[model samples]
Target: MDAGAGRIGRALGPGRRRRERPEVTLTNYEAVYDFYGPGRRRDGFTHPLLTFVGALYAPEVRIRPETVTELHRLHDAGVGIIVAANHPSHHDPFVLASAVYDRRVRFLASGTGLTKDPLFRGPLRPVFEYTGTVPVFRAKNYEGTERAVHDAAAARLIGLCVDRLTAGGVVLTFVEGTNSSADDLRTLRLDSVKKGVGQMVRGVRDTGGRVAVLPIGIVYRGRELAKLPPRRPVVSAGPLALWEDPGPAPSVDEVRHAVRAGIDDALTDAWG
Candidate 1:
């Protein structure tokens, strides 16, 4: 086995077979690197680069500054939190990160976005590293070259790094797992949710870690939350509810409802 294969073998274990997805073509590696590489290094500086760009480039979106201001307020109140929100658009991550800028939370992401040749990886991976962003491996299913990368991640358990992030501090996750074009939220693939978040919450419960799950709502009214024609964004933060001790790990339904509820409440207030 090569170095990468050796890595994944240890982390993900030997039981599962690798699967392939046509939608996720690897040929666009250059395109991905060109676009996402530089931003990775700039992720931590000055209000998260994307948020600043969105605000400047898409000023018409119109999200009240007060929404983020409220998030800061909660941070000041001393809450160790994990924020879960709906991923309606590509910009959702930036908008969500901006909402909690005052808190300085780390993000957990899929490894597929970061793995690459060293020349490209160096500049592109640091922002993820700086912000405590850890990667979850998605390459375990391939029998050939992809399997090699999967094995690398599995060996390091970089995919399981969410457990470490949750143990260390707050980590944000997009429970939906992927971005959606429609405003209507999709069903949480309970299995995916279980693997990432369930493991985090369960780990804390089994051992000991300060984990507070918080539901946040971002209301992008009118053209505020657009990714295509770029628009101004409006975001709202909801009051947090902590899960009880030994409380069951939140189900996909539970989390979705909470997040959706928060979003609904936020939209109501922002529009009204």
Candidate 2:
């Protein structure tokens, strides 16, 4: 009974995911990962090995160096950058990270998927953490719990990290919060912008650091992965949204529109 499962079992009634576990047995995931021994199939927990393999085998499945150069230029600007992008596929984070190569960027990930899967919980979870992914807890919590147990104050905490790296670094946020189904803009799903971006902006201002947002749009030539290798993905980097005020962040709609437009341009130029 890991703390999370125990918490879930106690709170979600008798017949739930945790009910499958024996009454007294606990889920010691660290031990499970140790037993499994890091393997190539598990990309979530395996760290350096997995990262190296992913880069080697999928070298062609990456962002272009030109895109990376533009990203570096934004870093050279000395403003904190929040990469608000659309999630068109499962490899979205990899696409973003490949372009960001070597930059100190952190990703705010949805906690639901990573924590729930046995595979991720066991052999592949470290890769998730090592890549600067701090999962955001979105589940509704039991009484007396202010926020979801897994994600309380996550946004605030990540905001602080952004502040600490204020001079230059990337904070990748999928404005939709999930993968979009089509080229058209999807409804922004993370709710309206919360205090996270605002807190980061204030921290940067107080420290005399600058803050900006880069809307990076990624488009798959054929969206469908079952298709041939003829369709290479394209990423478009838009102009930065430099913060002029230390107040609330841009609404999700605003970021979505910007990213969509950028992707449109990038896709048109890449294959046309």
Candidate 3:
């Protein structure tokens, strides 16, 4: 592997796969499903869009130097990076975006929230796919939606993410599957990682790609209950587990639990 200079390749290259249907918005769920396939869209706009996103959130958070270094290290190695992070608030996407502004990153977004939540149906609707966010279906989606629909959508979404990482991209996801809704921001439930992380790891390995997991802790003070807003929240990347050649394939459940442990340990250490 050409593990070198990850900081050098932040711009989007040609033939980026994800896209949106400007003609038919997310409200038209049928159109969305049709338009949301692999290699269907382009990233001609993501670089600049990310620049704006990073700048917008820069003032709200302080990314740790070591975390930035870790990102660069993983990218330089030219290996797929899966960032399993905590979800404290909706603002996390912005904060995390700002932290990894220099890397080719994608956020795993919630299809359920987008399709079901009234707030996202407006201007925010486009935001889901605008900045390279990957929408995923889960059992947690809209009521009455068939399990088969989510199953099919999730399978396709996972394939798309695997392809992106196979091409040596960085993907960030909240391990808890959704925001913690915690009373404060000091601690998080890292043990509660969703199923995607393990799926990604196995997919990368199965598809002839090297992958690694980074346990990142979002640390800050002064949330809604405090005297100030999160003027200097921190995104700290640490306690990583790089790709290793396991003699034989491990079950998805095993990979999931191992990742959970790594993330939980990292978060616990950071929280203290």
Candidate 4:
């Protein structure tokens, strides 16, 4: 068992037993890609599982009222939204889902999150699959031919997100690409926002579809170390920044700057 799980298991004491790790059938990247490909059917029926887990772990979530109103307005207007948020813990996805349950946003998740562990592969995989979560394979996780395969898969996933945006769907992504320590929360400077956000925006612009990026800041209260299932994390949403192309499309750096500014504003709200 991983150290984190081991600690939780010990904390459960003799009275509570850890559930047996379920058997995982999808073990390879090809299998995972085939199963979670964009063409597959996703009913989003398992989305409530995110809410259930979020409530169980972060029951006292606080969200800005105005932010909720703004999100509703955007959704009602049929605007494609890309929810950009900082990733401090694995629990951020669930907590954010609980905070914005009404949006019914699809998550852009790492491929490894689905197939890395038995627990994820068995029980939790369905939640992602059925909830329309887009799994992206990182080439860094593989080598040689495997790396090339992942690279192609990642490209295809980007296209899928672009298509979703063009179709006026809501997609949530962690702009930082990787989780950062909560200790850095005070600094307020996010890890360099990845180029993927810019690429997605460019893709949408290329299609001449209207899309906006919504920045969400997640702050964990009284967190000294990175822990699973944070305690009472606060989610703050900033105003939506629309990226439209009337002439030449905005450069990737420009998009990145806008996203960064939006995230900064949301972070300020979260800390305030």
Candidate 5:
């Protein structure tokens, strides 16, 4: 057998036929918006599955009690929350979910997770689909008209996030836009914050409501950072920074700075 077939055989084990790959077309943003919009049914399976996976992989996940209490207070106040977290490993999502298991939250994730390689398609993609993750197509990944289309899609995702916030839901976003290695994690500093987060906050403010930006920092401790199922993981939550609609709108840079500072604070707490 060829190397590719041999690998597939190993993944499937001795006598099983290969599962047929689904035809995943890149649909327009309108379709994506409608699918995850307010009227969509709540998922009954994904959360439990995520918690299970997190337990199995990151059994030593640690989170502060104060963080939990803060989250409760914000939710009790009926404020929309935007969780801005630093991305250290792919395991960060599962770790964050396990940390904040009490709250129903949606993630703002890359569209590539939907159409990427086998690892993503086989196991991870379904989690994104079922968990109401807003898939964002990075314009840099495309060219010409395709880039323009994807850019528009990314913009539409912001509006979808605003809708979620306006309806009193929590949205978790990785402000760095990509993952960093454990070696880099030692510094405990966030990478450049993305502008999309600011856009979502601004959109929510435009609709006149109370919104809170909650920053979370995730730290992974393991010999092999790239290995599946990370080792001990630590999560820290900074105080919720509230923004009310009546004040002057925050500039994108201002929002980025706030999120950056918040994540840094969380990182310090996580290391402590």
Candidate 6:
């Protein structure tokens, strides 16, 4: 039917007590975030990894921001950026990752691809893990009776996303729930978006963190992967998901519709 996506990542914080122990003097996440700070260019998916991923998978993903003024402005704020894009290829994450040439970016990576699959167990595993890519297991693939199990897994990953988002991070995701069939590899399916994204925006706003949901559309022409495409990423972030201060947590269906409309508009802009 469709492909997969990440649920929430692991939630970071204290134990059940939920108290900050000043005596401890440091946090596990603080060390982690520090390692992946602005100067962490050399650690994770550095320039070398981008080259490798491009050469092997998506060669078309080069960051020549034609009109990403607002996009960069949001990134400079140090809050969090939700880069919502369409999934037309398995190389979507790598393509989006390239856009952050001068900054850092994280994404909801497929757990199966990163762990169970042969392609990721070797060199790619370490790179993705280091670069802040949270691996998510799609419970929907289990189909019928296994929904509850997948829900738990998804919640954990989402908890992790909430913390990182409020703490200033850049996340790339395919809200369409699966890959599209534009390349003839799969059907161009844009069924619907999961509600985790909406919750993230609301959660961040509730905590007083400024979050921007930039609707990014990725378009591919023909079925070639090696040769560069005529058009690249389109950055038309105008009417964001939460433009002003969010009032209440919107319904899942409402957020889903907004996400679709925004992505559709961005895609139209990219094509023209």
* Per-candidate RMSD, Å: 10.7, 11.1, 9.6, 11.1, 9.6, 11.4
What's the lDDT for residue 125 in model 3? 51
Clashes within 3 Å, all models in order: 16, 7, 3, 0, 0, 8
Task: For residues 1-272, write the lDDT of model 1, one tens digit per residue.
Answer: 89887777677778742332112223333333333322233344533654565555342222345544543454444433556655556666556655554333323221112221232345644444444343433443234656555445433432243344343445576655555345443322333332444444545544544445555444455453455644555544454545435554565355545555554554454455
After superposition, which runs of candidate 6 have C-alpha atoms over 4 Å from their true positions? 1-45, 51-67, 102-123, 140-145, 181-190, 224-239, 243-246
lDDT of 3 at 153: 60
lDDT of each: 0.45, 0.46, 0.57, 0.62, 0.63, 0.50
Q: Which stretches of candidate 1 lie over 4 Å from their true place?
A: 1-79, 102-130, 138-168, 181-195, 222-229, 244-272
Off by over 4 Å in 4: 1-34, 39-44, 59-70, 102-122, 143-150, 181-184, 187-191, 224-228
Error of 2 at 196 (Å): 6.1
The C-alpha TM-scores of every prediction are: 0.51, 0.53, 0.69, 0.72, 0.75, 0.63
Best by lDDT: 5
The TM-score obtained by model 2 is 0.53
Clashes of 4: 0
| Model 1: lowest-lDDT 10 consecutive positions | 108-117
**lDDT tens digits by residue: candidate 2, 143-243:** 35544433434444444445544746555666555556553333223342344444545556556666666655666656534332223455555555566
Candidate 3: list runs displaced more than 4 Å: 1-74, 102-120, 181-191, 222-229, 265-272
For model 6, state the Cα shift of residue 225 in Å: 7.8
Count of backbone collisions in candidate 3: 3
Q: TM-score for candidate 1, please give it.
A: 0.51
**What overall lDDT, based on C-alpha atoms, would model 3 receive against the true structure?**
0.57
Q: Between prediction 1 and prediction 2, which has the larger TM-score?
A: 2
Q: How accurate is candidate 5 locally (lDDT)?
A: 0.63
Residue 198 lDDT (model 2)? 45
Q: Write model 4 residue lDDT over 70-130, tens digit each, in one string.
A: 6566666656678887776667767666665533332322111211223344556666555
For residues 1-272, what per-residue lDDT tens digits would candidate 5 score against the true structure? Answer: 89999989989899864644333323445665555444332357665775686666553434456656665676667667887878777776666666656343223221111111223235656666565554555544444546657667777677777877777777777777766655446443434677878887888888886788888778764532666666567777776677854887677777888888887777777777
RMSD of 5: 9.6
| Consecutive 10-residue window with the lowest summed lDDT within model 5 | 108-117
- Which whole-number lDDT from 0 to 100 does residue 141 have in model 4? 42
**lDDT tens string, model 3, 137-219?**
44555557777766666666567667777777766777777666663245443356667778888888886688777766675
